[model samples]
Every structure is written in C-alpha cells, then in structure tokens.
Target: MRIIEPVEITPALAVMEAFLVQPSAEPLVVQVGQAFQVASLLTNVPEADHPVWLSTKSYAVGDVVMLEHRNYEALVANTNKNPAGVGADPPNWLDLGPTNRWRMFDDKIGTQTTNPESIELTIAPGRAVDSLAFFGLDAASIYVRVVDPYQGIVYESSVSPVSTDGINDWYDYFFTPVEVNEDFVLLGVPAGSYGSIEINIAKPGGTARVGALILGKAAVLGEALYGTSVGITDYSRKDRDDFGNVVIVERGYSKRAEFDVIVQTSQVSQVQRLLSKYRAKPLVWIGEASYQSTILYGYYKEFNLVISGPTASDCSISVEGLI
Candidate 1:
C-alpha cells in the first residue's frame, strides 16, 4: 500500500463549524452527547460491530471524528448504570489484522514435476535461502526433492509430510551456505527440459495437494563483492615557506560509482592564493615527456567536481601552487 501525506486546509471559525457537520468515511466518526464504543476486532467483542466514541464539546450531530489508529487505547466502557465494574469484562486488546499471502503459478501449463529439472533462481550468489520448500496435498505422504545442475541434490526434505488436516502451509526449508556448496547459479533450461522439484507420496490414503511453490533468498554474509572505494586529495598551497601537500577529505565505501566531497577552509583568501599559483606558467607532462607549457586557472568559487575518463588509472595531477 502507498502512503500519502495529508493536505493542509485553512478555515475560519464560522466556516469550521459548518465543516464539522460533514460525515466522513474515516475510521472514527463523532456525534455530540451520544456515547459510542470504538470498533475493532478485539474491543468490539464477540459481535465485532460495536462503535467507540469520544466526547468533544464542539462535536455536532453528524460530525465525524478522526482518531489516529496508533494513538487510541482500548478499554472497557464506563457507564452510570454499570459504574461499580460489577459485570465489566477485561479491556479487549487491539487486533492488527492478517498479512496478505504470496501467490505463485506455473508457466500457463498446470504441470508439477518430480524428476531432476534445472531450476534457474534469480538470487544473490552465496546467500542462504530458507523459503524454498515444496509440498503437495494428497491422501499420501509426499516429499520435495531438488537437484542443482552444478551441485546435485542441493535440497531434499521429507519432514513436511502431507496429512488429512488440509493442505499444510508452505514450510520453510532452511539452507545455509554449507548446505549449498556453491553460490546460486542461474542456468538456462532447454525448450522441453526445466528444473524440477518433486512431490512424492509415501503411502496410500494420503493425496498429493500442491500449493504455490515458493522460493526466497536472503543475504547471509554482511558484505558482498559489489562495492567500491574512493581516494581524495587536498593540496594546501598557502605559503612559499611551506611545502604543498594534499589532505584526504573523506573515505567511504559504496556499491556504486557516485561519491561526494566537502572542502572546508578558514578564509576565501587561502583559495585565491592557491588559484593564483596554478594560473602561473606550468609545464604539463604526459608520461615522461613534457606535453605543453600552459597555465591552469581555478574557475568557480565552489568546485562541484566530477571525474570520469577511460584512462583515469594512468592519470595524475600536480600543481605548483603556493604552499
């Protein structure tokens, strides 16, 4: 579900009174002088239809009250008739409701296989997978068997045996890095051949009923190979008495190419002094040969720099700015 931010509305005191009378489909609705019980799976009790209300002075006859679902507390209602707590039940707890179940299907053809078929899983390599379990609903005991093309019999389990007590929920087949020797390899299957997971019934009277065959992968290792490192340099060209040196600004690791750098200076004069030195006649060299004699000038006050080139590995920059 998508989350949306609420729009801000401004209304005058007289207009607010008229706006308060409108009914809303929000979770809470308010009515003046009338008491209502908050409706929820737990608080509404056995019937699940009780309405909960809060008293408000400005509330009109049909005005709606919106209560944030997270803020309200569930408690037994107090009344003048039952003030002594004589027949009052314990406060009902709030219920958050059920989560949606995952859905799966075969490729248009309703065919379930048991023989060794190559299954191509788009999974992170070397990660442990736990949700890759197989089951079938039949009046017989069944087991799920899997064979990896590169690594044979990566997973086989008879623990989730079928029973008469309806189709069992998808059981998790836990596999650590040790179970699957190699990293998960995605292989292409031939036109007729495909990766197979089998559901074999052990005995009669038990039927093989299959739900969606589900598989999920999670990273086990804290770090992966897909990451990058950056090196930065800051040259201090302030005085002729001092030697120019580069200062490392930031050091971080990312799995992508982009990065950021921040330069902090005591005064703007330091930057100007550095730029003036670079603008002087300088000898540009590529490899061991002097390519050109030119002056490099620093343009902008703030440098929003991006470095990209094919031969970046062999490139280096040296400036004779004031130290």
Candidate 2:
C-alpha cells in the first residue's frame, strides 16, 4: 500500500493565478463550450458567490451564505447572527462545507467542480511533491505538466483512461458498454526548484468534472499481495410499500477494499505512525497501481498487523471510500 499525504493549496501558493473564481452574489455558471483558464480566474481567490453574511441584513430560513472558506445555511430566520458561531443564541446556521469553487480541494469525492469543455489551473506547492492522485473524474483526457522557473518544463505527460482500450475482440468492442476511468494517478513526478504544476482537463461533449485533486509525496507502505477483495458501499434507499410495491431512491455509492500485504518489520513503526497521523484524514490508498479496483481515496476502517517472522510481517487493512 502507498499513501499520499496532501498539501493544502491556498491563494498565496498559486504562483500564476489565484485558484478562485470571482465572488458574486448571483450564481455564476460556465456555459457550454466556454473555456475555463487561469487568466480568467485570478480575482477574489478566497470567496464564493453565496453572498457573504451580513450582520445588518435579515435572512430567511434556508438562505445560504458564505463565511470564511465554508458555506452555511440559515436554519432560522434571523439577523445579526454570525455564521461563524458569534452572537448565536441557538445556532441558526448549518454548516455546508466548502463552496462550489473550492469543492475540488475539499477532500470529498461526492462533490465535484465542473466546467464546460476543459478546465485548467496552475499552482506552486513551494515544497517538493512527487505524486498526484485524481478521483471521480469525468473527462476524456488529462494533461499534466511541471515547470520550473530556472529549469523550464521538467516533466509532462497526458493520459486517456477509457474502457475501450482493453477491448481486443470485435464482439466485445461492439457489445460492451464504454466507461471512463474515475481514478488515476501520475507517479514519480520529478521535483524541481520552485516547480509550478499545471493541469489541463478536457471532455468530449459534456462538462469536465473533477471531484478531488491531491498533490503530495507518496510513501510506500507495503507490497500488496494477491487476493485483495474489492467492493462498494451503496447509499441508495430501497423499500417496499404497504401495497407490496417496490420503492427505490437512487443515491451515490463508494468503493471499498480489503488489502493483504507484506511489510518489513523494520518499517513497522514508521507505517504505524503514518497510519495513526492520517487516521481521521482521508488519503489516497493505492494497493496496486495497475489495477483500478485497488486504488481507493478514503479512510481506513480497520487494520491489523502481525509479525510473521523476524524480517517480515503480514498486515490486513479495510478501507472505505467517501460517499
């Protein structure tokens, strides 16, 4: 297993342009065929368009407002009640998490940041980073490039993940349904002096959507052995009415996996420390890089490690993805 500890990207870290959209009271929607580039997204890097909370203005129930980097909805019609937990008699606002513009970095794979045609952005992480992991992608192609101020473009690669690539027979090609890869990783990214990472996303006809973008240094935990189990946790509701009719409410689902790996006893302490640090935090858990089912972006539910010999140990972990 390999884990990627992500680095949070703030407005100051973005060297080319701020990674925020212009804050407006009204909703801003990117039209079809519109280009979302870095030059157009440099203004007001910290705020969203949910209309900032005003102390003097009266708000009704269900009214949403943006405070700090998160969004909150009014639970009761009131004024002068701060969403930041100030002047709150009974907590009139409910936290809604990060705004739409910053949803890609929110670490939730269910929420997506979408754009028409393509979405491009550039950022400088300051420190050296060796890996990038993408989850919940809805695009045709992905282009990644790293640039250094003095060394220029150091590394560049493009990937197109589709199910059609494995179709070898004519019957399967004509009958099988086509699906795009939702999770991908670009490993072994060379670190440069003050490197700026650029990511370009493109879709064939619909909008380009990305759930999360993780940039960090990858640490190898252990070698994932065979017989790893993979499954999914579905959130859909199913019920039967009194009349014996079936009722179903479709909802999102998450991937899960059970990994059996062999780790060196010498590195057991380091592995335990790393897992304990990210116990509550979500990180990219890669079992086998070549298999899509082994790549999970979520938290571990349970793990157990036992010493089998002096030099080697066996470890078992169960991970559950975010819904």
Candidate 3:
C-alpha cells in the first residue's frame, strides 16, 4: 500500500492550454429589421484575456469580469460596482461560478473542467514526481509525456479508461451497460530538474472532462491485507408517494474503504509523519496496485497502529472520499 502526497499546481507551477471556445469581441453578424446585432458570447476566456473587475471601470449589460477566483456577469449596466462586494441589496451581477480553466484544480470533485474533444496542460513541479492520478474523468484515454532539458523527451505513455470486465457470457456482453474507469493513475515519471510534464486527454465527439488531477511522489505505507473493504456512500433519495408508488430522486455518491496494513517497525515514525502531514488534505491511497477498486482518492477518517513484534506493526485505516 502507498499514499501519494499531492503537489498543488499553483499558477506559478503550470500553465493550462487555452480553452478551445471563446466569445468574439465583436458582434458575429448584423440582423435585418433588428435594432441589436448578434454579439458573440464568451464561454471561458484565457488567463491573458480574462478581465479583472475594476472599481474605476464602468460595465455594460452582458459584460463578464473576474473577482476573487470567481466570474460574474453584469446583470444591468452599472459603474464602479464591485461584483464581490455587498453594495446593492440584490447586486447587479450574477455569479457564474469558477472559471472553466480552474474548475479541475478547485478541490471540488463534483465540479469538472470540460472542453470539446480534448484538454491539455504543461506543468513543472520543480521536484521529482513519480505518480499522477486523475479523478472524475469523462474521457476515452489519457496521454502523458515527460521532457528533460538535456535528453529531450525522456518518457511517454498512454492508457484507455474503458473497462471490459464482467462480460463472461454472450448475453451479458450485449446487454450490460458499457463501463469505463472513472479514475486512473500514471506511474514511473522520470525524475529530472528543469523538466516538465505534458498531459493530454482525448474524447472524440464528446466533452473531455476532468474533476481533479493529483501529481506527487508515492510513499509506501505498508502491505494492504487481503480483507480490505470498499463501498460507496450514496445520496439518492427514495420515497413512497401518496399512490403507494416509489419515487426516486437521483443524486451523486462518494467511494469509501477500510483496510488493514502491516508495516516495518523502523518506518513507523515515517508513516506517522506522512499521515499527520496530510491528515486534512486529499490524497491517492493505493491499497493494491493491480486492483482498481482498491485505489481511493480521499482523506482518511481515522487510523490506529499497534506494535505486533520487534520488526513489524499492524495498522488499520478508514477513508472517506470527496464527491
């Protein structure tokens, strides 16, 4: 078993590719017998093009601006009004939520960053990174490339998320819903200074969405015992209507797990330090490398350790995931 200590990709550490779609600065066309022209609308603007909310600038209706990591659109033409400040009783701005370029990095797994067909980014960690994990993915495949300054492209690999498991019989193959992996990890990134990692996601004819990306060095905790357990915490609601019929309200769910591990006595301090350092932070906990069900991206609820012998100790942990 191993835990990946995540590296936060701040604005200084990486640069995301520009979102493919952007609103035109000018009207797209002039309509006949109409007083207003068809103006191009902005979807997600690039960092360079994103306009910051300025108290000295006057805004017109349908204008968008950024303030405090969130985007807001002007509901009515106004001047010197702060979008984030509480001035008017009902403010003249409508909250548009986080920008598409930063949705994936916001630590909210349910809010995904999406783009048509594909999404790409380049990042420099300034340190060695051995593992990269993705969660809440809605893409066909992932490609990773590492480049070293002296040797050029040092390593590259790609993997598909589509899973063809549980298709034993002919009928099952045809009737079963197509299942794909929602989370995946890429390992063995070459270690080098002045190097960068380039990631690309491809989903032809559909939106390529990613909720969160974790890049870090993995630390071995212990050997995950065979009796580890995994399940989900569902939030769906089911109620009986007046007509005695069942009514279901669908909602999201989060994965959960409980596991035991055996670790060397000498490494107890190291393991405890790692756990303490990331107690409140989310991380990739890999229980068994070959089994996809055993890997969870979340925080540990609780953990206890007991010294069993002179050389080894027994540890138990429970983890709860972010939706």
What is the lDDT for 37 in model 3?
Answer: 13
- Model 3 over residues 284-305: C-alpha lDDT tens digits? 9988766677778899999988
Runs in model 2 deviating more than 4 A are: 10-48, 87-91
Determine which window of 10 residues in candidate 2 has minimal summed lDDT.
Answer: 35-44
Off by over 4 Å in 1: 1-130, 133-139, 160-196, 201-206, 218-323
Residue 153 in candidate 3, Cα distance off native in Å? 1.4
Q: Write the per-residue lDDT of candidate 1 for residues 1-323, one digit (tens) a residue.
A: 00011111111101111122123535334454322221100110011222333442233323222222111223433322221224434622233221111111221112232212221112111122233322121223334455433344555655423221222344332222112100011112111111233334333432233322323231111111112122223343334334656544443221111112212223223433543443433211111111111111111122222234332211113322110
Which runs in model 3 stand beyond 4 Å of their true positions?
12-69, 73-79, 85-96, 168-177, 239-248
User: lDDT tens string, model 2, 196-216?
Assistant: 787887886888888888888
The lDDT-based order of candidates, best leading, equals 2, 3, 1
Return the top candidate by TM-score. Answer: 2
TM-score of 2: 0.81
